[model samples]
Target: MKPLLELRRVFFRYGKRSPYILSGVNLKIIRGKVYCIVGENGSGKTTLLHIMAGLLEPEKGEVLLDGKPLKEQLPRARRLIGILFQNPETMLFNPTVYDEIAYAPRQLFDEGETRKRVLESARLLGIEDLLERPTTSLSYGEKKVVALASIISYDPEIILLDEPLSNLHPERKRRVLNMIRSLAAKGKAVVITSPDLELLDNICDVTLTLSEGRLKEGG
Candidate 1:
């Protein structure tokens, strides 16, 4: 079967004269599998995720979704992929937690369906009680959960989580890990990025190390 998403010989950098952050990086994301990318602070893990999510265009190679160029398949690609930024605060802007999670669903669903999606996502993240709270009032970890719920509410086929375990309490960390596993079990292509390999143990089906602008198997 064709990969759900594929990056072929991708290259990127911030400026024309800047050194490349990603040099000929290649990856294939498949459904039902969890991929963990372990990299240092400047290893371009977030850049790779942005390319896969169609947020950035690679300087050289190409990103494909279901064999079609991601640029050309953007409309479909947007509906298929969801990305959680390294800082959860960057993804949260709505007033209440319910409004935050309901943002995307409300764009595509009716009132009844939107409410159902919002409540279900909040329930999945064990943040049902947080629905009424203001986004600015939540703790960092709670904000992360709320951010994740916002993504899950739309039921995208591919989920990219950046530093998901950071700032989370041990219990919340376990909850997020279990949620990743559940997403994979349900045939969603799950990608997580972390600096620490130990935190991702037993959860990822494939662990890749990103260093020196390349991606390699094993952490």
Candidate 2:
């Protein structure tokens, strides 16, 4: 079967004189699978995720979505991909949690549908009670859950999470893990990156290590 998303011989660097952060990276993301990328801090895991999500262009190589070059199909690609940045604060911007979660849906749906999507996503994350709260007043963990709900509200085909378990309490972590499993079971492609392999145990269908600017199977 063809992959839903693919990276071909990807390479990236901040500047012409800077060292390459990612080199010769190739990956295939298929439906209904959970992929974990394990790496140390500053090992380019987040950079890889950005490139995969089309937030950054690679200096070399190509990213493809549904067999089309990502650059050529950016809008369509973005509609099908949801990404959670390592820092939840960076992803949240609306005044209230409801608005933050409804932002994307509001663009594609009418008021009624937008509210439905927002409420459903919030319920899934057990944060429905926080919908009326000010985003600025939420704790770090609350922000993360809200950010995740924002992505879930859109129901993207591919989900990219950067250090999703970081800073989350045990109960919240378990909820997120269960949610990942549920997403995968429903045929969504889920990719998660973390500096520690232990945090990814039991959830990954495949675990890959990023080191020396390349990805290798097995962590």
Q: Candidates' TM-scores? A: 0.98, 0.98
* C-alpha lDDT values of all predictions: 0.92, 0.94
Clashes by residue pair, model 1: none
Candidate 1: residue 123 Cα off by (Å):
0.8
User: Which portions of model 2 miss their true places by more than 4 Å?
Assistant: none
lDDT of 1 by residue, 124-185 (tens): 88999999999999999999989999999999999999999999998888889889999999
CA shift of 207, model 2, Å: 0.7
Scored by lDDT, model 2 comes in at 0.94
**lDDT tens digits, residues 55-120, model 2?**
999999989999989999877668799999999988989999999999999988899999999999
lDDT of 1 at 135: 98
Once model 2 is optimally superposed onto the true structure by TM-score, how far is the C-alpha of residue 105 displaced, in angstroms? 0.5
